[model samples]
Target: MSSFDETQDFVVVGSGGGSMCAALVMRSAGKSVLILEKTDLIGGTTARSGGVMWIPNNPFMKAAGVPDSLEQASTYLDHVVGDHNDTPGASRARRRAYLIQGPRMLDFLIGKGLKFSRIAQWPDYYDEAPGSSVPGRTVVADLFDVNRLGDAKSLLRPNFLNLPAPLEDVMKLPHVKKSWAAKKALARMGVRALVAKVTGKKYVTAGAALQGQMFLAARTAGVDLRVNSAVSQLIVEDDAVTGVVTEKDGKPWRIGARLGVLVNAGGFALNQQMRDQYIPGSSTKHTSVIESDTGEMILEMTRAGAALAQMDATIGSPLSLPPGGEEWPIKPGAQNVAAAPHAILVDQSGVRYLNEGGSYTEFCQRMVERDKEVPALPSYVVFDSDAMASTMIAGTLPGARKPDPWYEQGYLKKADTIDALAGLLAIDPAVLRKTVDRFNGFVAANKDDDFKRGARAYDRWLGDPFHKPSETLGTIGKAPFYAIPVIPGDVGTMGGVVTDEQARVLREDGSPIARLYATGVSTASVMGRTSPGSGVNIGPSFVWGFVAANHALTVAG
Candidate 1:
């Protein structure tokens, strides 16, 4: 092993949102920081996500006239994330720390030149829960000009969609009435791109934009980033983490840190062995996270006496894999399409198991629950031609005149009638027909007696606003029914090394490991098994990163 001569004040082993936040803070605090990323790209799964942050009472929310308080946010967390606090890794203190410091950290980042806008229409996952907000406490990053980063932009991970506007603007595309308003939006976007190109700018939006902004901020703060370096082990001295050994260029290099080592290397979503050992389902091929996240840092920390928690949990969702068994670089889940109107999910028995309009996480959880009784390994999303023509389905774009490749490849089954479709799906024809008839009755009555779909504000938000009576409940009466197989996929695994309120990694005895900190998916998620809102995954990550960096800075002083 080759040992590096230089010693930094802090060493961050990952380049996700959490590590970026921590590196920014440490650099701002005038500390020598080194960021080591295993992959060539700088951003991790954060670049693949929606890039929204669920920061209750954030300055953006306040500016938008959204009412929120710490107490109210605490109550909401208590209601949703209750009992999980009693678990080994989760605690009430960590939850409070997340809620209290989240907005402050976001505001700090905003002050450091990160632009964000409030998502006023996004509802909390459980809006009916105590102290929940109808309009969520989520804020998404504004579109960023990646040209500001110049050549550095190439190092950033690409998002699922490369739209050159904010996500809010992108969401309006489906609602645009094909009139001048729609033409104007598209024209404006094109003009913006043209202008940006003329001005030597490259604008990116959503998660890509968020990471671009963060990269710019970190660069401005003079963070030393080293990509293609994977941390192999933590260097411990007197029971305190002092450095790390990284594998780079087919060699091992040891680097020292004066303050601490922050483990933010993400989860093991792509690791099949870990998934099989922890997650409920057997398949590990369909995660929505980047392939580089294989829990290396978590394993290093665990070897150094760190405790683990919430190992069985994941931010699960239902996803339709690509045809011909070809995997994309980044797999995008069919979340919105599955929740859209006229689409009903059925088990192998051709029976509806849960509300199709529920949150993606809950939908996957229900699939897992149903799998216990029946072999619902691959659930079917049954929809009609109207749904296929009116909106996107299983990644199929709207208004596509031709049949999808999935249909031609047999990944999607289609028939002129529900019974025929069920026959094609190898399901009981009578049961599927009865299920569709019952669902149509529920749509006509504007009430779901079976699953209570479209009852919550969140469900309605994901539904068709133009549909009468209910947004999420519409009849699947149109001919040419279609069925697509959906498997349990995850945004990322949520469990990892356990940490305390200050983001310090802890031992099994609940004692902190000195000079060792963790943030993001490297540690047990503070949200536990519940996802409170759209950005819950990223919100606490930012806060904990800030907390960890500040604490390490104090130690350095």
Candidate 2:
């Protein structure tokens, strides 16, 4: 038997959103806990993301009078992601577990001194479905001052966006050019930044805020948190995971977990070999997750007899990579390419397909599925001068404000007439013209009979809210028309080691591996393949992490 170098009542691998939740659970039970992070930084991809958790019936939603219930959430899930054989992680038992416990997790975090609020009116993707929450159920962490962490702040992972304002206020700033209220919000953000600077406080929003607060709580509770201590392998003892072999000072350091090991490490979205094997035609270059998500922990768990499911599944996001967008973490994210009131997407054949304003994951999945028949990998985001005048595309300013490289590199194509635009795009002039005319007809009737673009409340939120009669409906007939190439992208892959309702790693034979647990993207997603809402990927990650710690404590006792 291997000698144990050190031991804790509980051990958590990977500093993801749920990592601290589990550690905190152990701490609350008066047991010692240790968190081992592979990278030098604390907070995994959770810090780099938006940090919103799609927790149904969260306290914030109830406080705001937004109606949400476990039953209702289950009904919505039934419609968006019904029972499926392939995604065993999203079994009815686990799905029910997540919904019931999500609120409890939120309450637990709050009791631990973390603050959270919701994105009010961030509707469910399928509002047309029965029991859908029209006002949304996502809960976001309040802006946290990184300076509060002192020297530990430098060890925390950075968020993708540096906005000092709250997320809700930040969401409104995009409309600053058109709305006075938006401009006022922008001014407020400026004031907040100034206050933060003068007060010697450094504020971080989105994922960073959530992770920072969790880190702070864990530290206050005296839980051991270490970085650069990469867990190379899970130490199993007679079919039960009891510890881990992490590299310390360039040597293997075997740390024993007296209770269990919880692996919240991310998934394999960036592993090109795995991408090819599981989801072919997908590229790592297009993913939005941190490069550290290589799925090694998953392999370690598999070697320990854990079963895997939903390997072919990912949280797909439709993205438009501008010519120079490769320079940043967030590429040209035109998930709603045709979602603006005046724009639409077209394939190489100049035909408009699927509604663009629904779920971003679905949008990209449809893109990948459509690519089989028509060349749609580089589908074009088509809009006219009116669209340029009204709003930005893929968060970039329109018209002359765009960089010269956009046109020079052909990433952005333009033409003075529909015929000339067709010539530029190499599509038949008649097909382009006919597609535009048909879309214009839908706009005129204030109806989208073809794909029903504006049929859902969530879809309308993607469009110009100020637009009359319809938020997402507008004529695309005006020339000179513009187009930008969009590709399917994702925040991260959402599949790995399968876990049961209690968040225990399960073997292929349908039995739980004693004391072994997993959460975050390291486990097969609880929501399965379909992304039900904005934070479906994250909500389950936190809930199961909390559940794992409680269950492990019981077993340890």
Candidate 3:
């Protein structure tokens, strides 16, 4: 089983969008590269993601005649994230670097083979917050022909669980697409899928569309992918990363890197122990991370003297299913469309704790605080049947198949009175009833007096487009009441080993872990504090991958 592999120029750990893109970028530069993935699948969290990218002031926008500038993007970033360097100076630096390079990195990808179809109508997450751009900043990869990566197929996994409908279909809805081109693209995908499937063709997921394209780009350039390869630890010599000692197919394998190893193995959202240590109250609710994301690679690097930042922060929205429901226990998995209603997210005390329309990370932070302030993480989403009917739950789509990981798995309780629903959730029944009554008055008035939810541009973007009086304001006053016990669920954790702006992993003392690089969720997310816009997660991932690859090629690692 001893493969005894020779030294590679660059070794990348994890197959998420970041790892794949970085590997491709390196390979394109004629650098010797080896990508190691823990799972047999190549796509990590990337395959299960929305796959859109927010590359502000990108050339693609300019090509499409969309008006935007770097200055405007910087203004937007300042307005949304500000200069919150709470986690030492690392957080602020990472944020600034990401924002500055996000556009350039995206342009580099376009120069490669990656194509971006503009989601022209998709607004910045905080369009109204400050200097946000309108139309065309968010871009998705053109649907890929996964068949291009022949042998890579066995190494890649598609997201068949979480998102029930194809992203192409979902974005085609009236509220989503404000342009004719997007509508046409949606139609084309439908026609193509039907034609391709009838001819016994394999389908490509949105996550796959982005990652597979990167994989194919790398492979075409002769990049090496080492599957079933697990990095045991970093080979740190003289306070710098020289190489990595890994196990391949059950045998010790050491790969010397002249440049460095990029630890993009992703965060520990899927690791229960790490979740408990970092996000205590939400230890059990993170549902969107890949199973390989145990943070083992991160822990190994930490042991080799890497510094972790924002370790305590996690990101997730609220959701729940029925008791004894296999799928409802986690947050990212359970699609509680209840938030579309005027229902408020409440603590066990039955009091609202956060702006219902805030980003997932902010919500999780508040949920953790609320849980600590009260008792447990049994936060509830209080709504009624009317809201339930019109809202679109994440996993409960119309015609998707069974063995659905997020199917009807949590309590979908209903009661004639608000008090009864509160009783089911074990909340202070009187307080719960009163909160609902107050929320109802606001809904009737069509305004969010407390949080001013729909009052913001980002909230309105994800709000009910049909509800005219107030896109994000609705009441639970209609007949049968509902209360789904929500838990703090995360798509994944977004921090890891420190790295420089070039995506090179760095030591605790601000020294480079030579030839070592990290990107995606494996690095402190480039999006700083709150999630700025749609695709914030994947945009920087692709950009960093490009940077790391180019840097490695030039460094002789």
The prediction achieving the highest lDDT against the true structure is 2
Report the C-alpha lDDT of model 2 over 1-557, residue by residue, as the tens digit.
Answer: 65799988899999998999988888999999999998889999899999989998889888988888889988988888888889899998899999999999999989878999888789988889987988999899999999999989999899987999878888787678878978988998899999998999999999999999999999999989998888898888887787999887789999998899999989998899999998998988888888689989999899999999999888887878777576557666885556987788999999998898998889988998898999898888888887877776656654446778878998888888878888899999999889988998999999899999899998899988888899999888777788888888888998899999999999999899988999999999988888888998788889999999999888777
Q: Candidate 2 lDDT (Cα, whole model)? A: 0.88
Q: After aligning candidate 1 to the native by TM-score, how far in Å is the CA of 180 from where it should be?
A: 6.9
Off by over 4 Å in 3: 1-5, 88-93, 134-136, 161-168, 172-190, 198-200, 323-336, 397-410, 427-430
Query: Residue-wise lDDT of candidate 1 within 249-359, one digit each (tens)?
Result: 687788998889988888888788887788745455677778787877777788999998888778777787757432755554665666778888899999998887656
Winner by TM-score between candidate 3 and candidate 2: 2
Compared with the true structure, all predictions reach lDDT values of: 0.82, 0.88, 0.68
Minimal lDDT window, size 10, model 3: 398-407
Query: What are the TM-scores, per candidate, against the unseen true structure?
Result: 0.95, 0.98, 0.88
> Candidate 1 versus the native: TM-score?
0.95
* Candidate 1, backbone clash total: 0
* Ordered list by lDDT, greatest first: 2, 1, 3
Ranked candidates (TM-score, high to low): 2, 1, 3
Q: Write the per-residue lDDT of candidate 3 for residues 170-190, one digit (tens) a residue.
A: 654533334465466667666
State the TM-score for model 2. Answer: 0.98
